[model samples]
Target: MGLVRNRVGLPAKCDLQIKAKREVCSFEFHSVPGDKSISQRAIVLNAIAEGQGTVYNVLRSRDIESCITILRQLGVRIAWNGDELSVHGQGLRGLQAPAGRLEVGNTATSARLMLSVLAGQSFAAELGGNALLSARPMDWVVQPLTDMGAVIEYLGAKGCLPLRIQGASPLSPIDMEATVFSAQEKSALLFAGLYAEGITRYRQRCQSRDHTERLMHYFGIDIHSDNDVTFLKGGNAFCAKDVMVPGDMSSAAFLLAAYAIRGVDRKGSLLIKQVGVNPTRSGFIRLLAEMGLHLTLQAEAELISGEPVADIYCTPGTRLSSVLAEGNGRIQSLIDEVPLLAAVSAFAEGNTVIRDCGELRDKDTNRIQTTAGVLKAFGVETSCSDDEMVIHGGRPLSPAIVNSCGDHRIAMTAAVLASSLDEPSIIRNCGCINVSYPGFVEDLSQFAHIDVLPAE
Candidate 1:
């Protein structure tokens, strides 16, 4: 099955319209899509477990679909009966090699995580992706796997995709401190560790998302984390359990930002229900709070899957302030939301400087450059560098046509920013929003003036 596209009468490549004259973003409660990170892991990890596992509340986005499709290609049996996903695993050593090349279009998460699963398999498998996914940095994942005895050949370009991967049986485990803050890389090595005999140790300077670690424990794998260190015991088998995915906080940020802005058509608190508010993953909330947006959380019972869910309450701010984004943990937490933060900062009183963002250049397009485009579309100006952005706020937003850069986040950010101003604006190539948040245009249109149409 292909990735799900936008369902609100949108063409493959569509444009988004945001008119500020629509109903204000006032509501008592809302729910976004299921957590994409958790949903992907729940599907991939459980598919390799010893028995059949059922996953609930899975996000049926294009990215998750990519992971599911690739896993099915690798011989896992997965079926969706209504909202429940039934995945039957052949255990740690039972995964079958695909008959042909595995195609993962525009899904870096699926491609990267699947690399580790394929790394320890006995046979060679070829993995390829679309043009955008091919350009992402796979060397970060490859070099580490190569160190562990996996034989990887680059079919296209070095450090890029279209790779021919051959497994290394009884792979060598190593102890090293991670130089990059990547949960995907960390998860890949952890998966590789499952094939090795000894204990595998991974250390990081700061915590990224811990969903992988959490899910490992949920599946009964012998994995533990202390401070910045993580240890995984190899040669262990695990069983499957029913997993519940919480609502996506990343998706909630756009709505909360609309209500939190000073002069949007909003007057009250926006309640977002049943969101995964994991501290390491919910840094966007803290980033907003730092800029004087009022937000509170009512905690929900932790899922047996180790995901923490909560209801978020956000009130629009009267006075906004500048923010500084630094440190590895802070950078990782708000990484996906930086573009949205930049768009929201345009109405703040001062310059919001974001640093430690060199990784932004590695996204679908150059996110740093695209975020600059977003800020400019909002009539905000500032200085930009390879790793830093200073958004000058308090400027009058203009009615402009902004390019989506073929990026879902950029398109969503532009649309969210435009909803707060009186002028109507257009975001080109917004159909990309379905990559992560399908039906986003329809969701936004209920509270804001937005429409999806064929791209010019």
Candidate 2:
């Protein structure tokens, strides 16, 4: 077997064993786990709401656990009974200060967005994270927050983690534009706007996720989007509302690629139920359709907690053709799913070009280069650049020895590619998958046999 080494200095955890048949049997179920993005938002928004809030289908993952843990430390009452989540609101100005530094684990989403909320509280608090989270840049979210009167003191590196923040009540609301296409940055601004007295306006570099915007509106916050611009009216107390989080689109994308590529020559279709179909997060769906995947979404989509929910049905075996997946316009939506696309595209009849992927550098690893390395390890020829990757497809694949490098998506993507062959693929450091989709191995088991081996 060919080897692709782990380069990010990740300690050995466990090996993921997945060997999928060349063809998959059709299956359908009611659940696919909750959306991580929506789950984190629901936990925070409802925690600071005016009354008690009930959240249905919140994903129990490491990333989301960070949000819940921090909220509890801030004196918010949250209870989850395995099915439903209940959060007692602290109102708009009620969160108590933690005893010391609030240590948020490896979740960057939890750290950045939570900092924005912390900026509106009435205490000076310090936020810290694990080594991985500490290395990421927080400037995009911090700068906007500072402009709104939040005093930020970096205890470590500038714009990185482990910092103290002092929030301003009646923070000055301002119209601002983002230099990066980031949903988190937009959400950081809007969430802090609740403490401001006037309207806070935000502009994006490109269209990104809008779960924050939609959830704000759901909880009776005055927020609206005109074209790509969003505005939030401040000083409004939130009314506790029930939120039903849809299944994660990011997780669903992995399932879709695995079954779709293998299903092409099989009978029957796989039905993925009640997954998010937000247009802002549907770039991969559009791209796959353009690549000739046989897919159908329910015509009558349901709206849950301000997000579109639909049952997506797919039958594999359609010949895939490569289409340009450019970054500027579609990167925000596809950033989390590009690895899956690039890996599955190895079966496509032509060369697949993914351009302007520089944003991937800021992920847990340099995913752009890491993805190229994984593909090459599987005997797929690839041309990689700083901002672009071209995968030469339509060739036979060999068994591969790959590493996740602590990236969940990269591991899952490589496993999906391995499932296409008769031999199993060994993925090191798969514990990282718990950060996002804890149920992924079970879900993928529908198409293959998975073995969780002890780390040496």
Give the number of the best model, judged by TM-score. 1
Q: Which residue window of length 10 is worst by lDDT in model 1?
A: 1-10
Residue 275, candidate 2: how far off, in angstroms? 0.7
TM-scores for all predictions: 0.95, 0.94
Give residue 56's lDDT in candidate 1 (0 to 100). Answer: 90
Candidate 1: RMSD over Cα atoms? 3.1
Best-matching candidate per lDDT: 2
lDDT of 1 by residue, 1-456 (tens): 111323343466888778764443355545678888888888888877889999997887788878888899889999998657899987877889899999998988888888887887888999999898898989988887888888999999898999999987767887868867868778878888887788889997678888889898888888898888899998777887789988888888877776665364445557778889888888889878888887888866698877889988877765778887788788898788888888778877888888888888999988999999778766788678998999998778788899987888888888888777666888899777878888677666645677666789
TM-score of decoy 1: 0.95
Q: What lDDT does each candidate get?
A: 0.81, 0.82
Candidate 2 clashes between residue pairs 3 or more apart in a chain or in different chains: 263-316, 263-317, 264-316, 264-317
Model 2: runs farther than 4 Å from truth?
1-12, 22-24
